[model samples]
Target: MATTQTFICFEQAASRTDRRKNRRGYLVALLASVLLLSACEVRLHANLEIEEDESGTIAVVMAFDDALASMAGPELGDGLGEMSAQLPSEWQAEPFAEDGFNGIRITVPFESLTELQDALTALTQGESGSDLPVGELMGFLGDIIPTREGDTFRFSLTMPAGMDQALGEELGPMPIEASMLDSVFDIRMSLTLPGEIVSHNADIKVGDTLVWNLSFADSVRTLQAESMLTSAISGALIWVALALAVLVALVVVLLVRNRRMRPMAHSEQVPEEG
Candidate 1:
């Protein structure tokens, strides 16, 4: 009986040791996962909406994964605040949270395409005293200035093929690996025009909106879209001209009929006198 009780005690101790080992293993894995996620996960979206009068707004939203946001803690909020403070007076910014993402949304309104280009240039080139990940990625997008030819509007953007090398040359050595840049970051852009879509090299097109998911590649990547604006005034003028022509034709017909009837009535009355 004494030997059997001793064996049972040893088995119980072994089981307790196994439980502790399993818990430690789980803790280690959880920490590693958090670190990996926090190291590389970001999403950036930029949208440009142009009105019929060529005036419009540009909205840029930059968000991070929930794990990354939680890990960054107050530092992320502080960085966004600093960025907002540095923006121009016309630019507006507010905190954004959606679909488990935490970030900021910036809006800039422009009166013309030229002004829009200027705003985009400032956004990509302006100096902000924060190390926000979105800033460097925005620099990768080349200048996007839309042109107007009569009733047609067009714009094209070429994504640099050698993005990592260019970034290294312009902004010094990058901390993220070249191969991992695409996987770690997601960049998307959409342009909403005030006309019917004529042609576009976008990944998705919904009516007048063209969306492109940007990525780094070995060859030149070009995104071009053209739209033709329909003029309401021209349509109205055509209808007015048609109505006036119909009125003139009706007046001529009535005058001819009246002249013929008067002659007939005169002949009839003169015959009775004869």
Candidate 2:
């Protein structure tokens, strides 16, 4: 009877201890995900190769600062790993690391842009039709922008709202200092375009490759400003407006000439009465 009671008491204590640790982990993750910000240096380089048939391959390679992977704990890394694992098996062949950076290189094949879009949406959001946690955690990553021109592809990443943007007055004190987090993290991007790329607006352009020279901190600031700038009318629209203005001016000059000529004709038709 004594042995059985002792065993049960020990088991109960162990279970309680496990529960406490699990609670701690939950609190830590919740606070971090909700209050604290992700590291600033989250770099993703996606290489796209599209055929004339709209079928192609896409390789999304991502890397981050070691300090970030270490500090953010397994939540950050595991989230990333989960993202890569969720991809189709055939395309998950690339090694997850290169040089000194911690990363995952996912190479996927697509039958069409629509198919690719579905895969991308899944990556950002996750597979649907289940109660499981598919992609809720990734919502905090950032705004991922992808622009495609033929076989050329570009992605612009911005940190999450509360994490990087200029905060509004309503949001009370920030959970973490920007400067402190900024010092420990950084992000950059690059792309390997297909075919002979003769035109590009990237900071770093080498043959067919494009790269952004800005740091993640600088990148977010610049991108926000860029967003504001691009909201205006495009250059082509401005040119169209100018063309309309010129046409209107020419019409006004023609009308003035016709009116002046009409006066002369009316005077001459008065049979020189003066």
Per-residue lDDT of candidate 2, residues 43-144 (tens digit): 445555544455677666566556455555555555555555556444453446655557666666878766766665655444330111222323222244
Residue-by-residue lDDT tens digits, candidate 1, 136-159 = 456544378688877788888877
**Candidate 2 global CA lDDT score:** 0.46
Lowest lDDT 10-residue stretch of candidate 1 = 23-32
- Note the residue pairs that clash in candidate 1: none
Off by over 4 Å in 2: 1-44, 51-53, 64-85, 88-94, 128-186, 194-198, 213-274
- lDDT for position 162 in model 1: 44
Assess each prediction's global lDDT (C-alpha) against the native.
Answer: 0.67, 0.46
Highest-scoring model, lDDT: 1
lDDT of candidate 1 at residue 19, scale 0 to 100? 30
* Per-prediction tally of clashes: 0, 2
